[model samples]
Target chain A: MNWLTWRQHRAQFLFGAATLAVITLFLVPSGLGIWHTFRSTGLAGCLAVTGRDCGDLASTFSDRYTGLQFTIPLFMILPALLGVFWGAPLVAREIEQGTHRLAWTQGLTRLRWMSTKVVTLVLATLAGAAVFAFLLSWWSRPFVAASDNRFSFGVFDLRGIVPVAYALFALAAGVAAGALIRRTVAAMGATLGAYVAVRTGIELWARPHYEAARTISYSFFGSGPHPGSGDWVLSTRTVDRAGHLLGNGQSLDFNVLHARCPDLPGPSSGFVSKAPIQACIQRLGIHLQATYQPGNRYWLFQGIESAIFVGLALGLLAFAVWWVRRKVA
Target chain B: MTTPAALTATALGKRYRGHWGLRDCSLEIPAGRISALVGPNGAGKTTLLHLATGLLAPTAGTIETLGRTPGEDPDLLPRIGFMAQDVPLYRSFRVREMLEFGRRTNPGRWDAELAQGRMDRASIDLDQRAGTLSGGQRAQVALALALAKRPELLLLDEPLAALDPLARREFLKALMEGAVDGEVTVVLSSHLLTDLERVCDHLVVLSGGRTQVAGDIEGLLEAHRVLTGPRRDVDRIEGVAAVVQQATTDRQSTLLVRTDGPIIDPAWSVHRVDLEELVLGYLGQPNATALPAPRLARTGAEVSR
Candidate 1:
């Protein structure tokens, strides 16, 4: 079984490894370049200390690595690519070409054949995703340290154990779709669509509710409670002294604001407006209330998301097994 | 000798989306016999072969091959070899590599010597890719792989459908040579009766998703007769047997019938029916009764006029 599994998937495994190597070769030099620029600009020491913001030098470093930043999102797409090319085609191609009859009729049972392929390819997907995440993490370290938005969707998802989990889910989805659809191209399309749907669902609806978000309200005209620089700020709203949550900007009436402050700066006004809106909000005892997931909860969210995806992946695999046994004929 | 059945299917049936592909099919193939399963294009021949090989699960009843439920236990896998329709092979691998695939996958039970010997005897190149091989070579490679498993029962579905006549003959010759001297029981399905008569001793014919006839080839041919006579009502003919099928032209009526009583009508001529004629006779008629055997009985040489 081991020998057969290897022979069957050796091409996909090699292609994944080669792609990882190419990505590593691309990241290492660019990473070093960022490190060198940070050190040469003397912002590395300044960033290491307290009460100093190296925003300018950080911006310069970011500007130098703009091309690298574009590639960071590409890391997020690798798992889906694995799903489409490696996972979808695994069983779909076999059934499509009718070689599954050959494979299933051997000394091994169809269940064993399917389980071995699924397990082996899943391990390979994890290893590939891990190597990719590690390389991308190394490349993005400087930018991550300089930015406060590391907990944002794009950055957090590609850095830790979650990418591996996502890879597992993607592969399982592909396999399930392939087993059901029995066509490689259609399965690949379904895998992509499902991956995107699940990712979007988690980012928009599920991730925020993983833990109750912490809200900090502060005095008017002041920065809201610091949930740490790396924390994910979900939303900031104005709250009155009566503790009523102000509707967001969409519901606020500009006409009422203009009527309240006839002397307010208009579009054609050349003068700079300092605090007209601030004064009005302060007069109403409006406070800045920021709701966010703290940086300390990053691992908690990661664990929750990984568990969700892994659970889904296992369910998809079970479905595939059932489909093969009961529905494939 | 009363050998045990290699395969026994009881009340076997398979239903597709809207209709049944095979229904109420029951058969028993004797051990150490070369059997042929014949049917038309839409008949249930492939469905029955698939059910026996465990490639498909019967929807209604049970089918057991080699004394075990087909595909129910992994241990039973090595005991039954199946070469599916089209002889599907891994085209990407070299011929030798394909053999190696069988070796690796079957593990401790694979017969490497038999595989290599068969390929060598066929003059198939070891280095040639399976996809690049001619149709006959591909079939040979597939057959060798199935035979190398040394299964007690081998189920082949339309194995010779795509081959040229010469290749077909050679392939059947190779199959018979390998099967005749052993305890191997082979069930081969094809629409062509001539391809089967030379190699197969047992027979089963499927039509309209039902088994029309089944028996030992000799017994089936011996039990059936084609009676030709002056134009007369077949229903009124004396000493007439079970009317399997009948055809009539302007002054002649020919009836293929299964009988236990002798034909005594002086106006009619009695002739032995061949395997092909018997199979075509049953296949052309729907709702045929349970045949005494799955093999079409071979017609005797002497005909009493």
Candidate 2:
């Protein structure tokens, strides 16, 4: 079985390795350029700041990280494409081409034949994912550490162990889809669709729960007293769980709001002071802050999620095996 | 007699939904016999081979290869080599790589020299990818893979359907040579009757998913006859037992008859039916019944008139 699988998929393994090497070679230089741009600019210091001002600087830093971080999404998508077209086709092509009948009639059982292919291709997918994860993580560490933006969470979350999970799930999904569909084009489309759905579902809805929760204040009002004499303070603000404002966890200062709203009457000019805006200020407490701090417990959360996907993958794989075993051409 | 039969199928039946692929098709092949499975398109020849080789499960029957049920016995798989009608070969694999894979996966001992010899005889290019090969070459490569395994029972579906006359002759010759000295039982399905007549001792003709006629080649030929004469003289014929096939016009009638004695009547002329004519008669008429054995000339000659 080992020898059969090795012979069957050696070409795919070589092609995958070559593709990974070429991508790394092409992207590493560009990645270094982004890193150099960060080191030369003073924006790196903004990452160390602990206030709303730092959040503003972090947005700027995110733009710098985008150059290198862009590869993370590409890595996530390209491997799945390859798995669908290349890995999925492994068995389908044999069956489509009529080679499976020849192999099945030989001494090897259908179960053993399919098992060899899945195991070999799975190992290859893991190796490719590992290399991609290592390179992407190593390159994007500086920028990811600086940004601290929630948007950057998608990028950082995908680069390291997350991509491995995605690739494994995609490979299994591709193989299962191919076995079920039995057509290359349909299998490829089904695999890509499933991959996108799983990635989107996990990133948008599931992974956030693994991190510290945070809430954003969507109200278009500033956190301060409204001065009388036709003065109204309007500002958009967001905050987190610690009663800290959105950009960074800092208490809102009404003195600054009053200064910005110069229309406020002199200190005693029939101004309501803090009374008029107190109701609006209390509404700020209604906003919930659940910040995702995945780094603190990366392994624990990753293990749980990986287990779930792995189980799904294995279950799908078993179904594919059974289908192939019982299938009649 | 002590040795086990190479292949056996008992009450073997296969049904897809309501359509019958094969039904009540039972056959037994003794050791070292080249059996030919002959049928027209969609006669379930390939389905029967698939069932016997364990590529497909029989819906309500048992198939035993080398004394073990094919589906339940894993060890029997390695001993039986099957080449489906749609010769399945990996497009990416070169001829050499395909043979290597066969030798590695097959439980039988690898015969590298034999494989190379067969490839050389077939004139197959070792470096060419299987997908790039021509149809005849693909068939040859498929045959080579099956032959390389040195299986106990070789079940080939339409192995010679795609080959040209020259390649077909060469492949059959190589196959016969391989089976000559071993206990190998070759059950090959082919539409080409000439090849079957040349190499096969046992012949089975399937029509409409059932075995219409199956027996030794000489026995089948001896039992059937083609009787042709004027249409008006048909009733004048005596000792006419059963008609396998009949074509009549205004003046002439050609009837394929099965009988055991001579047609002594002067009005009708008798001719011995060859394997081709017998098979054609059975295929031409679906409702043919058993006919009496034809009579042989008293001279004890091989050919009878």
Candidate 3:
């Protein structure tokens, strides 16, 4: 049964392997060059000096890797491709062509036939995803080390163990859709729509609530450092000393203030610098209250997100098994 | 020791949605003989064949083939060979690969020598893909695959329906040779009764999702007679068990009937019924209630033989 499944799906498996190989070939040499440049520029040593200053060195490194960083979003499409091409046609083509009758009546039972095909293909998908995640994460190590901001949506999903989970979820969704729909092209379409919907929903609504965000209040300064660059700021608003929420009435109150203090910059000024606004807000006893998720929680959030996707994948696979065994003709 | 019948059904039926494709069909096909199942379109012939082959499960009662229930039992698969309607095969596979597929799927039950001999004799080039073969050649390849399983009972559903006359003859010839040499019981379904007259010794007639006639061919033919006489009411004729058909004219009447004893009406002429006439008489009347219920019953002589 294993041998038969491999023979039937050999074309799809080869295509996936070839795509992974091409990606590796493109990333390996360029990744080595980036690492060499980072070492030669003493950027690592400067970044290690923590409290001193390495902003200039970090900016140079960011400028050099800007082109390669743009391709990070392309890695997200790999799971959708696996879903549409490898998983949708797995059973849909069998039924659409009436070859399922031929396959079901053989010596093996229907459950065994379904399990053999699904399990083998899932393992193949996992292997391909593992290779991809390793290559991309290794290539992005220097950038992550210098900048230390891996919590962004695209970078987070494209780098860690989460891509494997995403790939598995996509495969399971495609299989479930194929089993229910019983048509290859329509199942592929359903898979694409469902994958996009779930990913977007999680990224927007479900992810932030995984752990409660913390709030902090700080005095306003003209050109002083506020929050760290890695902190994902949810929202920032001005509040009184008692921590009561204050609405943005700067336009009306500041207008009154401008009438009272004729020395302040007028509306006709080409540019009103931040110094006056800061002095005015400080005198009014207003402070900046900001909510954010700190960067130290990156891996914890990744683990939680991966668990959510894995749970969905397993649920979809169970539905697919039942649908194949009971509902399919 | 006496062997069980090749197939036995007690009130077997299959329903699609709310409508019954086969209803209250009880039949027995005897072992080691070629039986012909004759029916018009939508008369439940294919339904019965599929049920027996385990391609479908019955909704009502029981059906046992070779003394075991059909479907999902690995032991039963080795004993039954079924070539479904239109002979579906993997078109992408070469003929040799298709044969290999059968061997691999059936594992311990395949006969390689028999399949190779049949393929060679039929002049089927195994190197050619199945999609490239003509309809007749495809049927031949399908038949060879079924026969290679060495099944005890083989059920073929309309294998000859799409063939030309020459191709039909060749296919039937191969079937007969396989049946005689391998001693396998076979049930073939078709609407053309005359074509089955020469090869089939056992017969079953079905119409309107019901069995109209079933028995040994010679016995069924012998039990019926066509009597032509002057115009007279059929009830007046003595020893007429049941009138299957009646044709009246201004001067004379022709009656087809089943009789238990000799017809004592000296004014009438009695003629023997052939396979075609007997099958046609039942098929012409979709409603079997018009005929006597007792006489419509089948003796199933082959099962008891």
Q: Kindly report the docking quality category of candidate 3.
A: acceptable
lDDT string for model 2 (A1-329, tens) is 78777777677768788888898997689678767766666556654554425445556767645555455566658757756866578667776777778778877888888888888777778888888878877676666556432134456455657667667788888888888878777888888998888867876677556544433343334333211111111223445335555433344555533443455444456555664345434444423233334344555666666776677678877878888887644
Cα DockQ of the candidate 3 complex: 0.39
Clashing pairs in 3: none
- Of candidate 2 chain B, the 10-residue stretch with the lowest lDDT total is B295-304
List candidate 1 stretches off by more than 4 Å.
A243-258, A261-281, B236-239, B293-305
**In DockQ, how does model 2 score against the reference complex?**
0.60
In terms of lDDT, which candidate is stronger, 1 or 3? Answer: 1
Q: What is the TM-score of chain B alone in each candidate?
A: 0.92, 0.86, 0.91
Ranking of all candidate structures by their lDDT, best first: 1, 3, 2
In candidate 2, position B53 carries an lDDT of: 76
Predicted complex 1: CAPRI docking category: medium
C-alpha lDDT of candidate 2 relative to the true structure: 0.70
For model 1, residues B14-117, the per-residue Cα lDDT tens digits are 99989999988777888888899888998988888777767888899888888888767677888878898888888889998899989877877788988998
Model 2 chain A, poorest ten-residue lDDT window? A225-234
Chain B in candidate 3 has what TM-score? 0.91
